[model samples]
Target: MSILTIHPKDEAQETALKTILDGFAVRYEIEPDETEYLMSSKANEIALDKSIKQAEEGDVVKIALDDLWK
Candidate 1:
């Protein structure tokens, strides 16, 4: 089985999507946004906090602006 990730454009679309899923009797699961998803795990939250702190301390590497596509 394959999983599908959907982002509803607005409340109306979200409601419509739910209605369609229900009508088709398709099973679906709702997931939290990225930040909340990561925070769901203690280890993930700790790692994210460390990464943020390091960035604030300028501990990240500097990359060339023109090399983004490379």
Candidate 2:
């Protein structure tokens, strides 16, 4: 079993692909659209990289659970 990510070029293609998969009874899941968050631009990736670097450098600030709502 392997995971595959398919980015259909348009809605028509997406519908056609899903129909074919349904006809074959292949188990698959349609992930929630993340175009806005994940692929809208490169900002998300840059932010993620920055966070990773901060974590690696131990530059994160820790807060207690009790202080979270404060």
Candidate 3:
């Protein structure tokens, strides 16, 4: 199966597309807004950079695989 992302210009267009999909019984999921998603992704990148810096500076604890869930 493949996934398709559609960016409708407005609510009317979105509604129209959804109606057609509903009529055809096509399963679909509404995703987070693009702008909001991008903002969140940026925040994650920043956090990852900080974590990498800490690891380089020996600021992380080493946990054994078996102790990870303890």
| Steric overlap count per candidate | 0, 0, 0
lDDT of 2 by residue, 1-70 (tens): 8888899999999999999999999888887686456645688878877888999999999999999999
Clashing pairs in 2: none
Q: Rank all candidate structures by their TM-score, best first, as comma-separated numbers.
A: 1, 2, 3
- Residue range 8-59, candidate 1, lDDT tens digits: 9998999999999999999999878889998998999999999999999999
Point out the worst 10-residue segment of candidate 2 by lDDT. 32-41
- Error (Å) of candidate 3 at residue 25 is 0.3
lDDT of 2: 0.86
- The per-residue C-alpha lDDT of model 3 at residue 10 equals 98
Residue 57 local lDDT, model 1: 96
lDDT value, residue 15 of candidate 3: 100
Q: What is the Å distance of residue 57 in model 2 from its true position?
A: 1.0
TM-score per model over all chains: 0.55, 0.49, 0.47
Q: For candidate 3, list the clashing residue pairs, or say none.
A: none
**Candidate 3 per-residue C-alpha lDDT over 1-70 given as tens digits, one digit per residue, 9 for 90 to 100:** 9988898999999999999999999999998885556557777768777888999999999999999999
Q: Model 2 residue 16 lDDT?
A: 98
Top TM-score: which candidate number? Answer: 1
